[model samples]
Target chain A: MNLLPGFDDILAAAARIAPYASVTPVLRSAALDTLAGAELHFKCENLQRGGAFKFRGACNAVWSLDDGQAAHGVVTHSSGNHGNALALAAATRGIAAHVVVPEGAVRAKLAAIERAGAILHRCAPTQAAREATCAEVQRATGAELVHPYADTRVMAGQGTLALELLQQAPGLDALITPVGGGGLASGVAIAAHGIDPALDLFGAEPLGADDTAQSLARGTRVTTVVPDTICDGLRALVGERNLDALRTHRVEVITVSDTETIAAMQLLWSELKQVVEVSSATVLAAILKQPQRFAGRRVGVVLTGGNVDLQALPW
Target chain B: MNLLPGFDDILAAAARIAPYASVTPVLRSAALDTLAGAELHFKCENLQRGGAFKFRGACNAVWSLDDGQAAHGVVTHSSGNHGNALALAAATRGIAAHVVVPEGAVRAKLAAIERAGAILHRCAPTQAAREATCAEVQRATGAELVHPYADTRVMAGQGTLALELLQQAPGLDALITPVGGGGLASGVAIAAHGIDPALDLFGAEPLGADDTAQSLARGTRVTTVVPDTICDGLRALVGERNLDALRTHRVEVITVSDTETIAAMQLLWSELKQVVEVSSATVLAAILKQPQRFAGRRVGVVLTGGNVDLQALPW
Candidate 1:
């Protein structure tokens, strides 16, 4: 319940992940800026190690563990970027990584986790199944369970990206990131607000997966029915801590459709030649959908990841 | 003919285009390195302004002339990257751009050129018609001509990429690029030789558009009958002057099939999350086709462009 990381945690995470993570370039899109009548600066976290910003948190978490704790290694449940990031971070430290991946996940994602020397444990195709299997693996191997988003360390680690962005582009009118499980969005909101309380923070959630948007409106973490979103990475229900952060920070929740996300993904590829996954597309989608809110503003958006299954890109 | 520009010309061109052009990052692909058993240092000109490296030469050529030239603006014949790059560069320099594009060229490319504030002069489907009309436009308006290749300034400008690459990765054993009208290939050879005469320079052309490969074998320029390559940017025959440059440099010529080029493009996109057009895949195709020549050595590959027709990606 008291798991929210403070500003100090984020600062410490920045120091820990400094050596491993890339300081991705902040790019101004002439085309997108002109289209939206806004000055948009994109923080390209998609270009970071593991092709996603998740590596920042994962690397910090894996490296900060004690020698004995690291020897036993880390375990986590993720079907996407977080799995590959933790796997790679663990391998870099010569420690073990046990990823309890759900069945029916992309083969390429699984291959990436394995290639990074992470031991894969398949489970039933459900969040409950993934978490339960992850628990079992932790019990069997005495591995430290690395919660992808809920862990204070992981959240602190993710917040470091915002710290870098604020340092690089000070006084950006607003900061926006896509919300899936709200790990990155929560972390970004906290970091950006810490730097400047007046800085507006927003979460772009896919329309099909608008759990966060609904919860933000209801002023509580609300459970969702079965999800349906072309953007695979934004399918997670909002967490309690993330909901509190969203409520506390007054993070505006805007939703964009699958069509807009696909259009945005193609634009990045066509204009910037930056191949990003649909998850990253959500930020662009939200901006395009709510142009009035963002127009004529100096806004910063994080392209959170780039681990797209090319053959299976969301149409 | 004593028509070529000396080192000073290239330096001037670099200075001219520096303001308008992107200092595109040179990326290293570890997965690709392992596959070929060689370190692949990719000079990512694909991410250059206008989604192609042509911006360098085009910008240089368009901006090199005096105030009179700016008054008349510029004209060129291209079915793809050259047209778009020239148009965008001309727009950035606050000048008019006249593009003589052949019918049957990609509609998307034509739209991009138009969007960049270029006046479109569409002609018959033949390259000859396009060139003839471009000449007419040049003669009528007295507009400065920025030849796609085979111009002293353009070749020297393109050579700048090789200069940067060599400076970035001095230990490179070889430099490889796709040849289309021999502009990029010839410039790469010249720059590579200028950096180190021992550096092996090779042109990786499409088998269907293997005019350069055949011409080198014949000791003169030999045009291919009908270009059948899916590498659309490499369909043009090598310009006479560019051929001479290649021959003078004693550059080795290699050819790969469309299948290999597409595969290489997909590999680069999926593994590295870099969205490169098919033309940029030539170097990788050659290495995959003849791994023996490249294994156990350091290779520098110039990804010439990434202005792909996204709807028509040959994935």
Candidate 2:
């Protein structure tokens, strides 16, 4: 049986990635609080080293490698934030990073990943094609496959965000994170629950891609429907290990429609004065949708990322 | 002779406004540093209470009132950030704020001021009309007049930004702030020079509205030219007291074209991942324009505010 990462692993990851990953600030907006009927603490991972929480996971995975394995470098299949994060993390370690990006990935995102010094191997815009391309490149280059959300080390790295958040604003009644492949939410659940067993953990997802919510309801991972949301970063199927972690922790999953997500995004932009992608807006949408769930409580909302194409803004 | 505010006044203002204003974070960008060939520390007043550093001055001015004046409240003529700042500051002190806003002011900005709970007095879209309305409101209400950038207390309050910046990032070789009516720049000059006499101070301005630059060259305040710039927040002519402060500190004035300012705004949005108005981008434009003067040095750039119209994004 595969064992899930414990709080000890999160502590170790926090120490391991301290030099690379940013201890992002916990910001408060009074306007946001009034709207939600809750005191909200936002962990601004959008201001993280690679402009996302993915940098924490990527950095931990890159640095955790043994010397022999390190020399071989790291490889991943990501069209956006994760690709840029892994590339940046690898550059810090002075190791090669091979990112397999699909053909229809946003050009701005592709440029950012390339700028971080990743060798891009383009494939057709499909999961099978991306995986096939990544596997072939790994074989050709002898690079170690660092699965974006499934790997234990990446989950531990993502968990460090919770560690920092709790330290920044301790005694949070609950925590909310966007669930795509379930990496961030899974890690957050582990860390927050480990610190305070009674602390409620929630996963926010787009209604169009409610696989995680559906999986939690069905007691199994579901990967049939194609995502149809503007949150491009949340199009991946939930990994088996990630599902195991979420289920074991009893994480409550909630989904918000794209219309609600867009409205929440506008409110965030107007209220918080920050530029966040549509993916990061899901948690706020969830809070606004069910105010009773979070009202009068201190809720921690993890802003997953801020790598956006300015020219193609959704608003 | 109008004596410029000293370090002690800034200290007093800091102490007075501590409860109302925010000690905003100083952020850094590695990519931006590499591009500018300088280590840049951005004092993000855009994240401050009411979303601007104007709150510092307004808060200081509001609380400095004696019992009779406090009972009567305060009044100002502003169509943007200052109006919002004063309204919020007055609310904190449990007093009325009369903001004389000109007709045809940006709808979003006017809405923000109103939401902050200011009693908005509308007037013709002209400086004389605005001043006349403000005077009438003050006379009718027995309210104290707080000129946006001209008053000694306001200048001292604005100087608190420099005090915080210096404390946050010590040993800076230079500091840059956009020059509008000269409140922020004048205040920054006094605070920075007071801390380290050797530190360089620069005032950034748009080529279209280069009144401060012209005033510095002519050794007097210039107020005749029709201001024309995309920076709506920076069209005001330099105040006499602000000019005295700037002249006393020997501030170097630099001007960048509106085109260059827009490019810098884009770069800031892409690199910094924050929604800042065009007025706030001039400092970065100045840094990028004069590379040799600032290359390889530590520089502090004050992001003055982040109030922007989402529906009318310049890009």
Candidate 3:
């Protein structure tokens, strides 16, 4: 078997997740294009099932299990889109989902996960506590652990977005996605490159959470910095498999400041009329930061999610 | 010519505005459907040019003019979507657009209109002053006056949305739209009924500005109310032609409270991941308030616009 998730894995994942996930629409904004000096085709994953592209991976993982593995159900430690996506995906399969949510997680997000039938296991906000809680829950329930962005299956599922996006907007010169745990970026880089070798793949990172950029620059996974970005969805460190995929596929990770990300987020909201989270806006931020590189080209941007606090708007 | 816009007018408008206006997508949200106890197919006009369905009418009017009329350009006294839409439409035709904006109108909206290439003529915040200013601009520029909702051509253009929505979602049981100047509702009622005589059409109005409801009830246009609603777009009294169409088509206008409209707007933003203005939420508010009337049926809803002041969000 191939070490990295091959093109076939993404194709299979696309087929597996078809009945469960949404084939979200591709959106365009002339105003935004003028700002970046590039024609952008935004894959609106914010409109995906559970309001994020995370559903694709979660759906794939929940349905890919063998009969015995399925009977035990699935569990994950997450406090954002991945947890909610997994809960909803498990609900569709009528399987138990245990979400190990760290303390101080957004109450609205946790409520949404619970609403999707996930049994919440709370722990201290630290990563160690989250891992310990997830492990304990896994041991007690004999549940299959599905890491948010580390597993090959999950990465393959995330790559399905590129498959759909490439089909929707053919002849895209470059593809840009915000890197979180690097699952989406790695998956996109692998699948997009596999489909068209000439396509330039880019990963956007917040300066406050620039481990992915740091790792790529150092040629090693970096995980020492404490993230301090408004893009809550992209605060996770780059996963080992994700870093490997990025390196192998030659994906360039560009970093932008939180202020720039927020400005891009407002531009997307005001100009595109799209309700995307700050993390998703980072892709556009990266494009604007180096407009000369993408000028007059057809660029594809992945809008990762649209879950935001209504009362507390960043603008 | 017929007293009201005919089916052929809508068809012609559809073709006329196709190049300029978007055939806005029909979106669905299961959570919103469950809340209203009905399956709603939302015609997302909020995603239309100038961020509202008003663009369809404006584009049609601007393009429909003869050589002499087109040379003179188009003029309107709108402090909102119609003004911006007309400006953009005129820009497309390489003609001048003179917009008469009131003093107290939204600063962001005014800036957008200016950016769209409309020559702004500011007037007092009263009706007589606005009309006087509009007439003066029209006289000076020899521009054709396009009433926001009263003109037959404008109404015909707005009807094109219904034509598109019906084709997108075949066999709809009913259709609903928020009534402000009555242009959208009048056009929708005419087009929807022309397509399917049996289809029920409903209009939503905020109680604070229930002139349309009163007009439909008392069988005569009511134009003497001091409007007081958060839906700035829907505060205008029913127009003469709009009242005629609404009466002829037998459209029912349902009144909702500001509280209800706000709640529905929040629900739409949270569940549908759509950033629509409060005016657009009135349709869902009406459905939720009278679920029994629409339960277990497929309804087409027109989301009017997405232009709202982010700094002063109702939520």
lDDT of 1 at B143: 85
Model 1, residue A154: displacement in angstroms? 1.0
Ranking by DockQ: 2, 1, 3
lDDT of 3 at B61: 88
Q: How large is the i-RMS for each model, in angstroms? A: 1.1, 0.9, 1.1
Report fnat in order of the candidates: 0.76, 0.61, 0.50
| Residue pair clashes in candidate 2 | none
- Compute the TM-score of each model's chain A versus the native chain A and list the values: 0.97, 0.97, 0.98
Clashes by residue pair, model 3: none
What digit string (tens of lDDT, one per residue) describes model 3 on residues A64-116?
Answer: 99878888889999989999999999988999999999879889999999998
Candidate numbers sorted by lDDT from highest down: 3, 2, 1
User: Candidate 1, DockQ to 2 decimals?
Assistant: 0.71
Question: Candidate 1 has which clashing residue pairs, if any?
Answer: none
The residue-by-residue lDDT of candidate 1 on A190-232, one tens digit each, is 8888889999888999888899988877776778646798877
The TM-score, computed over Cα atoms with residue i paired to residue i, of candidate 2 is 0.98
Q: Is the docking of candidate 3 incorrect, acceptable, medium or high quality?
A: medium
User: Per-residue lDDT tens digits of candidate 2, residues A40-64?
Assistant: 9999998999889999989999999
